[model samples]
Target: MQKMAVLLSGSGRTLDNFHSRIQEGSLAGEIQVVISNVKDVLGLQKAVNYGYPAFHAADNDEINRILADYEIDIICLAGYLKLYSPPEKLKRAVINIHPSLIPSFCGDGYYGNIVHRAVKARGCTVSGCTVHFADENYDEGPIILQKTVEVGYNDDIDTIATTVFAAECEAFPEAINRVNEMGIDFFWDRVAK
Candidate 1:
């Protein structure tokens, strides 16, 4: 199994969902580590409760230290808000799950419930998640995968995020599966480049 590390900046509902999937034997691996931007985010506690090593790191230097110390192979940003300057070890292996379809309403000010709110306000007929490489640009990366959700006439922000969250759970594991097939180190160099 490939070692996985997750980064989160908020409540980490996605992380919880991933952990649950692992426990249920659907995800098929270890979380290894969880890094949070804010020390007191509720997700830090969730990681602790789940017995994963969770800590605070504000920038790339700290992240480099953390990943090196843990010998992490893959880094998935699950609601993590910080912009990371990748060290060579993490460069190719880092990925992020953006809440929107990206190049559309995802980036900078768009995150969490706000992205959904923007989509609903714009009257988008569809919106979904994009799992991609982490780049200097927000939500802009070579796309790994995406799963779109149809937006109904009456869909509210909450409804949209809920639907997108479902897609996130599925996309994350699928990405992980593809990662496993790629064999961690091999793909990291290519993707990172």
Candidate 2:
């Protein structure tokens, strides 16, 4: 199993899903550490409750130190809002799950409910989650996978968010498993392009 470090800025819904999948032997990853930019968010609390090494780190240098200390194999950004600059050696090891189809509603200032609201405002017929390598920019990395969810004209932001999150729960683990099976070398080539 690959060792993972999870970073989040909101509720622990994605972290919770990872825990559930790991417990059920579905995901081929072990969460080594959990870090949150916000000190008191549900994600940090859930990490502590799960008995994983958890911390509050708002500085990118501190985050990099923790990742190095833990010897993390994969870094997963569950709902992290901050931009994390991974160390040179770990550039290809970071992954993130964006709540919308990338290139649509992703970048600085676009996340969570904001993304959902944008989709609604645009009258998008479909919304989904994108699991991709985390580059220096926000949501601008090589996509590993994307799962689409049909959106009705009347679907509210909350409804759209819920639908996309369900797809996210499946997509994140699938991406992690794919990385585990295919190896980072495969992604290294893709990300280099």
Candidate 3:
């Protein structure tokens, strides 16, 4: 099984989803470690409860050390808010699932309910999720896969968020599985200079 490291900054709903998928034998990866930028969040607690090695680290050096120590094969960014600059070999190994489609309500300062609110304010009839490789920038990496959800006019932020999250529940895992199957060399070769 491929080894994975999950990094998060919020509720860790994605973390929980991955755990469920793994337990159900849908995802073919092992979560070697969990890192949360925020210390007292529910996601961190959930990791501990699930018996995964979890830690809190905001410093880039600390994060890199943890990743290196675990010998991670893939790094999944679950609602992580920081700009992660992984070393060249691991650059293509990092993945992020965004709440909104890339080139849409994504990039810095757009996350969680904030993205939903922007979608609502913009009156977009469609909103979805994007799973992509994490590069030096935010939401600017090569696209991996996307799943769309309808956005109704009457839908509130919570409702829209819930809908998109449902799509994410499916899309994120599928993306992770796809990446795992392709292996890290697939990514490295494509991005090789």
Candidate 4:
């Protein structure tokens, strides 16, 4: 199984869900490292409980050290809110999950519940989640997978969040599977890997 390091700056529900999949044999991989930029993140404890190495990376040097120590194949971001500048050697190896479609409901202050609120305010008929490669920019990368959720007339911020969250719980694993299974492919008129 391939190893992946998850980086999240918030509650860490994504990591917890992945752990469950690992136990059930739905997802296969070792969580070599769990790096949270925030010290007080509750998800850190979840990693510790599962006996995965967890740490707080305060700066670029620290980030490089952690990534090196783990020999991680991919750095996955799940609700991590910090600006992460991967070492030049590892930039191509990181990815992230954003709760909205790219170049759409994504930008500054457009994360967490803020995303749901904006979707409702805009009266969107549909909203969902996106898993994309991570780059220096915010939520702007080549899209890997997306799951759309219907937005009904009665939808509120909480309801929208719930709808997207469910998709996330599944989409994360699916996207990872796609990357590890098929890899990304492109061609002049066709693509494969």
Candidate maximizing lDDT: 2
Return the TM-score for each candidate structure.
Answer: 0.89, 0.96, 0.93, 0.92
- The regions of model 2 sitting more than 4 angstroms off are none
- Cα lDDT of model 3 by residue, 70-133, tens digit: 7788889998889987756687788899999888998888888999999999999999999988
Stretches of candidate 1 above 4 Å error? 183-193
Candidate 4 lDDT tens digits, 21-127: 88888875668989888887898988999999889887768878878876766778878887678877667667788888776789667788888888888989999
Computed on alpha carbons, the lDDT of every model, listed in order, comes to 0.83, 0.91, 0.88, 0.81
What is the lDDT, from 0 to 100, of the residue 126 in candidate 3? 96
Off by more than 4 A, model 3: 184-193
Q: Write the per-residue lDDT of candidate 1 for residues 44-109, one digit (tens) a residue.
A: 999999999988988778877888877666788888887876678567677888888877888888
Q: Could you tell which candidate, 2 or 4, scores higher by lDDT?
A: 2
Error of 1 at 47 (Å): 1.2
Best model number under TM-score: 2
The TM-score between candidate 4 and the true structure equals 0.92
| 1-193 per-residue lDDT for model 2 (tens digits) | 8899999998989999999999999999999999998889988889999999999988899888877788788899988888889989888889999999988999999998999999999989999999998888898888889999999988998999999999999999999999999987787687556
**lDDT over C-alpha atoms for residue 137 of model 4:** 80
Q: Residue 79 of model 1: what lDDT?
A: 85
The local distance difference test score of model 4 is: 0.81
RMSD after Cα superposition, model 1: 2.5
Candidates ranked, most accurate by TM-score first: 2, 3, 4, 1
